[model samples]
Target chain A: MRRRIPQLVCGLFGLVTFLCYFSSHPIARKIYLTVTLDYWQIIFAFTLIVGALSFVRVNLRAVERGEDRPYKIVSLIGVVLMPILALIWGIRGGSPFMWVFENIQVPMQATVFSLLAFFVASASYRGFRARSLQAAILLGAALLILISRSSIGDLIWDRIPEAAEWVRSNPAMSARRAILIGIGLGSLTTSVRVLVGIERTWLGGEK
Target chain B: MDVGTLVAGLLTLAILTFLYRDNPIYKMAESLLIGVAIGYVLVVTWTNSLMALLFTPLFSRGELWLIVPFALGFLMFGRLHRRTAILSRIPIGVLIGSGAGVAIPAMLEARTLRQLSATVGPVFADGTVDISMVVVLLGVLSTLIYFYFSREQVGWWGRTARLGTWFLMIFFGTTFGYTVMSRMSTFIGRMEFLLSDFLRIIS
Candidate 1:
């Protein structure tokens, strides 16, 4: 009874939401707008809280087991501290919360992401070898794109930039479009599967 | 130097130190990053979503209909308890159902139909046959065929799929190059921040 009810609710809601998109009746539109805009956002917010709780639980377990105790403690402190700061001081633009965010969080994220530059360089050096026809074509195309986007290509040859642009607009765009179509079909099929009772993986193992 | 900038500079350096080897400082910074990110999200969600959308409407406006979603949202917390964990499935089901329903038609319109329409365009522009249009037409068709796994890739089918692969390679190559350029630009920005903003090495 427990499992059956949720599955029924899922199928009903899925059908309603899908039908609501096509329906222009005042009642349908109102329900659709309310659910999509308000309810979805509220649900997503709760999911974030759930995520935070899960993080705390996992880290607490790690600390209890005495695995990398110092770092785990730092992480736990950070998770607890920031919310208290936000709630107490309020997250106004000039508040302590925002100050920490702008300075500490933003810089750290930027630095971490920027490290991808070095990783990409190392990865490309290892992977971008011209061993076969496909590899040679890929390497050539990559070189053309890199050169065309920089000032060096214009200095070396006038036509290189034009050739690169042609490659992008023609073959690259066509392949991208084909991939997008495949993704669209795949998403549609999966959505249908979820709407039916066939996709029960979200129920999370025979509970 | 100011405290915030000084702290940011040190943290940036600490994170960058990971390139050399994983160490205590890098681990601490990574954890702090995760914590601060979640905290920020919690604050934003509370203010923008929960308080404004859920609580305000339910209490101040006296909208009783909102109780349905409010109850559903609360049920999500049931996962924390072993006995009530099955109750969490209700909310999860609703989320998946609504999300999928919303995405289906949108993807059909934006990705499939639009893409198909775009692919089938005028091959002949003015008095001349456009070479670029021909390339796009052939590329899209062949790539789609290559993706079709129902048939075995032997003889002529293999040759066509091979042609499709060449087009895909060009697409992938250009994407990788662009990504490299973007990451390199970000790396340069961080360097500028450290050099000019933090150390005052450049104006």
Candidate 2:
């Protein structure tokens, strides 16, 4: 009974979704959208509970081990208290939980990103050398885009923006589109396996 | 300025401080971020997935079919066991197969055909070449030739290919640099918001 549950789902909805695309029936598309956006969205949403449980389990274990005990306790407190407060009162634009969120999480994500900036400049200084014809062209493109992006570049050369725009629209967008196709293909392969009931790792182990 | 956006902005600045050097402000900003992410995930899941999907269906349909994904999702917990862990493959396989069905054709059409056709396209489009078409044709030819590593060059073909390679290299280099700056800007943008918004809490 336990084993049959997920296979049943993939079979029912997954099969319908696959068939829906080629079918002329409007119902197929509607059902497809509902299953994907509504049903799949629900399943994915609840997965967060899995993460919260893991967070609690690891942090509590850390507290038991007498290592980084203080931080672990603080983490556990935040994990527990914030959610309780949120569920009881709700979190939105003006609530305290929401306030804590905007003030805190945004900064952390931003800080991680900012650190990436210094790393960028350092990498540029060290590695931005031309070794071949291809390297030289790439460097030229980089220079064009860089100058055009900042106000300084606009002052030096009016053509920089136009040139950069052309490159991005033509070459960069083309390359990114190519990569996205590859990624899309890869995603399809995974999804097909899931639908067929042959993939099942998300269910926790192999059948 | 609204009090909410103001507090959020301060935290953003505090985070950006790390661009210069790490400090107490940065740490405070970091801690706040972790809390918020955790909180967001919980709240979002509860409202979006739980309330909308499961709870709604349970109340409205009284249909037991909703338990299908729920039960299978619980099977994800089977990984904790020692011997029976292979059971995880059930859900994973379905995910993989479904993913493949959608992705494979998309991959071929978008990645392979569109690009090959795009490169060979401009010249043939409307059965004629304009000035812009000429430049695009030249760009494509040169870039393609640039990658030819083993082709011996002693004739016109060799010289043309060499120029092609040169054009490709310069284009790639500048692109690399701009990508770096964009990343930095993203980082800066986040911190600027935090410092400007969150610091208001103290003030």
Candidate 3:
């Protein structure tokens, strides 16, 4: 009964929203905006609670089970420290909480990302081989993009820039547009399914 | 060198250690990223949604509108109890109804009409060289033709379909290449952030 009612309401809402497409009423637009705002709110509300639980659940179990859990304690400590600090001093500067975020969080994010350069280089080397006709075209496009994007290409050559411009404007952009068209059709079907309650995966799995 | 730059450089070195093999530096860096993301999400949710829709309406004077969302928020939390999972349906229904109401016109405008119009334009502009416009027209024609599942393709139309398929493959191949380049750029940008902003090893 619980599942049945939500599905039915969803179906009706979907029908009205779909019909709203045929008109330009301000009332309809307001309804649309309100619904979207609430949806975004609900998603965040759920995730925030879930993240909190992850810290508590993992650490509590680690202590009880006597596992190799040194890091769990540090994680739990971080979770508690910032919120408490924020509640007392607020999250602004001259507060330890904000200091931790700047000194710790941002740098860690940077550290993680620095690893990606090596990954990108390796991925490019293996994928951009020119064995087939299509591969040859791709390799041509890639070299153009890489050269145009970098300072080294401009230092030694001017024709490289011209060729890169030609590849990007003609072949690359045209190809991107076509892919976007296909992606558009797929998104339409997805939205329609969600409206009709046929796609319950987004709502967390089927009844 | 300043402390900020020295630490940023060391962080970069620490992260790059993963390239040789995974180690303690990578683990610490990974944990820090996860912690920051979780904290940001929490703060945003509290300020943006809970504060706007829930707290203000309920606590503020002369605002009876809070009752509806407060009840709905409570309804969502009812899922915590096994016997009261049925109560969650009300909030869930409201969510779906509102979602479908919002997505209709924006999707049509942004995804459908604008895109179709882009495809149905002239290849040449002012009788000048427009290689992009020409490639675009050809790509649109070939893809649209390839998906001709409704009609028979027994004659010259079959030949066109075959050509269309080849064009479709090339188009997809190029798209894949661009996607790779875009992802790599993002990765590079992230690396730059670590080196310059976090570690301060590189200017």
> How well is each residue in A1-207 modelled by candidate 1, as lDDT tens digits?
878888888888888999999999999999788878887888888888998899899989999999988887887777787889988998888899999999999999999989998998999999989999989888888889999988999999999999999999999999999999999999989888989878888777774
TM-score of 3: 0.80
lDDT (Cα, tens digit) per residue for candidate 2, span B1-203: 77656665665566667767878776655654565577677877887787777877876878676776666556556545547455544444344434444444555677656766765554556766554445555655655554455786658767777666555554465566666787868865664544454443332
Candidate 1 falls in which docking quality class?
medium
Whichever of 2 and 3 has more TM-score, that candidate is: 3
- Least accurate stretch of 10 residues (summed lDDT) in model 3 chain B? B169-178
Per-residue accuracy of model 3 over A1-207 as CA lDDT, tens digit each: 657777776777667666665667998766555555664475447545654766667676986787635555556666666667677777667676666676666666654554555676688688768777656765665565666666777887867778666655554555455556666666667767777777775444435
Every model's TM-score? 0.96, 0.75, 0.80
Error of 3 at B10 (Å): 4.6
Return the lDDT, model 1, position B6.
97
Report how far off residue A58 is in candidate 2 (Å): 1.5
Q: Score the docking of each candidate (DockQ).
A: 0.77, 0.34, 0.37
Model 1 chain B poorest 10 in a row by lDDT: B35-44
List the candidate numbers ranked by TM-score, top first. 1, 3, 2
Ranking by DockQ, best first?
1, 3, 2
TM-score of chain B of 3: 0.68
TM-score of chain B of each: 0.96, 0.63, 0.68
